[model samples]
Target: MDCREAREKLLLATSDDLPSAEASELRSHLTSCAACRGEEARLADVFGRLATMKRDRMPESVRAGYWEGLSARLREEGLVRSPGGARSVARPARGISARLAGATVAAAVLVGAFLVGWFAGLFTQQEKGTEPPRAVRPDTPPPAPRADEGREREPIESAPATGWTSDFALGNGPADRGEGVYAEFVLGPEAAGENPVEYGIDEALPQDPWVASIDF
Candidate 1:
């Protein structure tokens, strides 16, 4: 008998319904097949636990529908052989348990793959963390200058000092203003000397239209 036939005969094996010849065949197949042996062991363990559970907890219609559907599948799959009778009776067992075990195995595989990927990511991050940073050399060239940096800046002359000087010294009152386009003069302290130089309006406003020209 194959594993499928042996598993179908499993419940019958526990009961008196299984014929001796079929039992011998099942036993021989179990020795060779690790999967069938595991399933047989699982059934025995599960069936014992199931015995105490209430079977009538579901509504009558629901229970009937479930059993009817399962019965059709078993008959269609030839998982259970019906004896010669007007009505099909005595189905082997629920194959749902075997399907559930397969589903469980698939779930475990997905979880195993997920955990492996997660740990691999962590290991990769740790490897990156352990690596030392590269050092910058002191002689490395600086970043290129900006386009505007090469242009010359406009020169700004410093404002004249507040204090007076010997040459071109500012008078006490805000330097006098004239009606014409007059010159305003101020000198720094560095220009102080005995020979005081006078700064006239013409020297400061030589190009002004109103500047008074002097003739020698």
Candidate 2:
């Protein structure tokens, strides 16, 4: 047998997996090849040392601590009840952080909607070729009046003096003639702080007379 075959059988023999017939062939090859004999001796020494070494075991307190921590975590999560209590109280469906996050998202949405509406209105105005109304400032001056505004108004005229006359019940004009109708006239005060008591009449009527004299 070759040294390669002998080495394979040597590893199996160390684990007690090789058959008796293969073990005999491996031993004959090791005796003939010096290198195979040294390799078999090295494997025997490694296996012997491993077999003599002691195995370590996990501590009881470590397992107990792990189970206690898991039970505490389950209790905090409301998945398990306390050992002292007969029943468990359910936690709120929404936590403080969840409610706060909802409020923040709502506020952000409102602000975003307001901004979008404002921008849309601005863009629409621009598309329509219309300008937005500007705010009136306190310092801005009022519009000036037109130049012909004053001249457009007409002057008020006084009433005619004949409008104050009243017809008389006696003779039409004078005692000498009874053809024309007699009329009374009203006059204003000639000076300040003086009562107007002067009276006059005309004997002959004219078409348009400025003055006339008569006796009562």
Please name the candidate that would achieve the greatest TM-score relative to the true structure: 1
Regions of model 1 farther than 4 Å from truth: 55-216
lDDT of each: 0.34, 0.34
> Model 2, stretches more than 4 Å misplaced?
57-216
> What does the lDDT come to for candidate 1?
0.34
Summarize candidate 2's per-residue lDDT along 88-116 as a digit string, tens digits: 32222333223333222211122112222
**Model 2 — TM-score against the truth?**
0.25
Clashing pairs in 2: none
Candidate 2's displacement at residue 16, Å, is 3.0
Q: Can you give the lDDT of residue 164 in candidate 1?
A: 25
